[model samples]
Target: MKTRKKANFFPRFHKLFAVKKIFSLLFAGGAAGAVNGLFGGGGGMIALPALERAGYPVRAAHATALAVVLPASLVSAAVYFFGGVPLAVLLPVSLGVTAGGLLGAALLPRLREGLLSVLFSLLMFAAGIRMLLP
Candidate 1:
């Protein structure tokens, strides 16, 4: 039986363009953080692709993105809360969102990578179209 080897927590680079890789990583990280802070979510959308490009498997990338998004989300929520964004809306939405998040997290591991990619692409495309509409 063939065994799968675990990926390193930090990926190791071979004799490649190290400087460019570092710069790309820096840019991606900055963009993810900025998007999460400004939009109050979506770091994961930016982060998923960046992690995939950095050689993480799809499942790992998605999980890592949730880890990345969590703190950014908290900080943004705090800012909005203090800035007087209506807290009332949060109560209703948070319940559904929490349940949905749990369901999605539970389903992630069971999904095939190809199906997951297609679903994510469709979601991004739909979001883009929604933004372009009136």
Candidate 2:
């Protein structure tokens, strides 16, 4: 009686998974960057989960998302500035954002992971609903 040998497929499957992961990473970054440029914020809404799925802890993901958003925000702001957006409209908003951002950053580490996720989801849901309205 002749026995058929089975091929080892795990290595090939692992490589395919790695490739898919890389593509997901790139897609996440591109989406985040585009959102940042177009909306002036909300990149973090895209990036946070991406970072978390890429193996960062909840808090670390939030912080990393902020880090990614910062440069994109700056570039977008720079373009608006050079394109004649008024400092009168920008400065006060920027100051408020800075203060609020500092407070949120200080608060992030104090929150539990589940609470953070719930709050994040709620905020996103609210924003989505708000955007749907006139």
Candidate 3:
């Protein structure tokens, strides 16, 4: 049986950029990062495609994007806590998200590439329609 090789995370981070891909990466990352920073979700929804276009493997791009977002989440959580968001409400949601994230990490490599983009786009479309409906 052939064994799958593990990717070096930092090298993969560097690989996301090539001379020709600089603009694409900047635009994608800027757009995704801004929305994610503002809304607290949807960055990954944007990052995956940009990273893919820039030539990173979907799995690696997703992982790297998640890593990039981790600090953002932490800061957001801190702000919510300080702003008097209830711990009781926050705890369960946080736990569920963390558990689901762990599960997703374990299973991500097993999923077919490009599926996430389709799912994410559909989700955004649904969200948009829902907002419009009300």
- Per-model C-alpha lDDT, please? 0.80, 0.82, 0.74
Q: Which ten residues in a row have the lowest lDDT in candidate 2?
A: 1-10
Error of 3 at 23 (Å): 3.1
When sorted by lDDT, best at the front, the candidate numbers are: 2, 1, 3
Quote the lDDT for 109 in model 3: 83
Among these predicted structures, which one has the highest lDDT? 2
Q: Which window of ten consecutive residues has the lowest lDDT sum in model 1? A: 1-10
**Could you give candidate 1's per-residue lDDT for residues 2-115 as a string of tens digits?**
221222322354225455666887788789989988877788889889889988797898899888888878888788789885658877898999999999989978989798
Clashes of each: 0, 0, 0
lDDT of 2 at 104: 90
The residue pairs in collision within model 3 are none
Query: What TM-score would every model get versus the actual structure?
Result: 0.68, 0.67, 0.63
Cα RMSD for predicted model 1: 8.6
lDDT string, candidate 3, 1-134, tens digits: 12223224445644555434877777777787677768877777787777777677867987987876677667665765576877799899989999999999799789975998699889989989999995
lDDT for model 3 comes to: 0.74
Mark the regions of model 2 whose C-alpha exceeds 4 Å error after superposition.
Answer: 1-17, 107-131
